[model samples]
Target: MKVKCKSKSAFVQPIGCMMLSIISGMGISPLVLAVPRQVSLHSPEQSAQRQPQKIAQASGTDTPQRSQLIQQANALYSQGDFKGAEENLRQFTKKFPEDAFGHFQLGNVLFQQKKSEEAISAYREAIRLKPKYALAYNASGMVYASQSRWEEAITEYKKALEINPNYGEALTNFALAMWQTNKKDEALSSLEKALNIFKTQNRGEKVNQVERILKEIKTADEPGVS
Candidate 1:
């Protein structure tokens, strides 16, 4: 997803136009948290930061009333008012059951509330309403990753990538899942691709983060190194 950074305002601003991407194919699910060799899987802060922007962008075609409701929910979420956001989103979704973005935004609020199962359900509904909702797939994958369901996470990431190959956030997350599943080589390869994409997109922060991960993976892979 692309987030354009904005100046500090009274309400929480949506993710700036900066793009966030994820990672690919893997197997072997573990119940325990699978610490990646390099880079963490997902960041709640980052996810929260991006929600408003994504919701705004995706809601362009929504009715003004629905749009306002979504905006309110986004603001509430940004302000850390999870319950308020949840209530607003629930109302919004109830009013617009077919609105994919509404479901997606609801998922974001649920995720912030640490309601993983509910978040997944919301994301799934979003995807079901919009079969090609790559971000929904990516978000659902994140939930799976948090549960240490690496295989499931990878599957979700791959679906996101299939919809948009240059989805940087999905690529990065996919790489992380691969690494967690003990597929270091594959993870490094995916990271390299993600790094290149981020660089091309002029996403300096993501490029730097991916570079650091690449360095860590390479260092670990070096002969005689742990």
Candidate 2:
């Protein structure tokens, strides 16, 4: 995505304005409400090192046991049993501390539990275990963004993008950070690029979200009568 942003603190525009306006123009529900607070919904990318957690291809007798544990953990996660997932991931990591995937899964669980600092640390460990793990960098960037550390977030996102330029999640998230930091032009370019990429990729609800924001920005840019 090619969301460009400007580096100025000029009044950052609200994205929902345009979205609501567009919906109104379409003769849909004429609801009037304050804009919702923006939150990053994209989960950080999965670390390549941790990719084996769900599907371990290692040649070992313990593989089956490890896989079964991961499956159970996933089931728990899907069932909103975050505590159970956390326990499972913790035990798995203890047994396979050297496994980058284990660290990554633990980080994911910690993040879900709102343990931002711990999650970041776990993601860092995953990164250390596998320097080329693009997902770790992406996940770290997401944590940094949550902390409002735009520069750090940008750095992590860039690292992920470097590993894979087509990392759409990283691209869009980086754009959001840029927008938050008053990089309007850059943000727009990045958002546009993200929109284009998602049009072809099965990005699910993200496509609608980006489009909504883009529309709001466009409306916010319109010259309103004083």
Candidate 3:
């Protein structure tokens, strides 16, 4: 959210981890293995902005046709064809307007293309369709954070945590928004919680990143540290 005391690069994640780790609930399968495999699924909160693409896997009740469409979209998304994925998801949403996952994927594609407003709209629709959709709420916060809308981002992250208290990505991002708002102590507290979540999940990469941020935050608070 906001920064100070240091260069702020010590723990900055690539594009906010976009962690999409909350991506867990969506049904990601091996069909879209196009993403450069990073780490195996550990747990949520690992990150939201820095996460790799996670397309939805079909549910047991899903029609094969629908699953195929989602698979195709995932492939496009993994391949970095945001527009192509966008078009595919648009088609999917049009056909299944009530499907929260469809709108959710559409929102992800929009976010990648830098269409922040549109992405928010998609996420909102997903939430509307599935009020308990924590991932949609988290993704919405990411869009707000991307635009430096800290207050809004924090609100959405709070909503996500309410739905899923263990959401690590939301916790990390909520920390960023807190720091931006000058709630330094609250920010530190949030990051500490997030770090613990990653540690419990055995996500080494996320644990390392959160540790780096925690150290920097502590250093910044030291007497004479500029």
- Residues 1-226, candidate 3: write the lDDT tens digits: 1121223354332222222222221212211223224435545543332132332333332566776777788788888898999999999888777777778878888877789899899989988877877778888887787676778988999998998788776788787777767778998899899888878988776677667666666675567765
Best by lDDT: 3
Tell me the spans in candidate 2 whose CA falls farther than 4 Å from its real position.
1-56, 59-62, 202-204, 223-226
In order, candidate lDDTs are 0.66, 0.62, 0.67
Q: Model 2 reaches what TM-score against the true structure?
A: 0.73
Tens-digit per-residue lDDT, 147-195, candidate 1: 6577999999999889878777777888877876778889888989988
| Candidate numbers sorted by TM-score from highest down | 3, 2, 1
lDDT of 3 at 3: 20
After superposition, candidate 3 runs with Cα above 4 Å error: 1-61, 221-226
All candidates: TM-score: 0.73, 0.73, 0.76
lDDT of 2 by residue, 86-196 (tens): 898788778777777767767777766768799889989988877867777777776676555778988998898898776666677777667667788887887788777
Worst 10 residues of 1 by lDDT: 26-35
Which candidate do you rate higher for TM-score, 1 or 3? Answer: 3
Candidate 2 local Cα displacement, residue 156, angstroms = 1.1
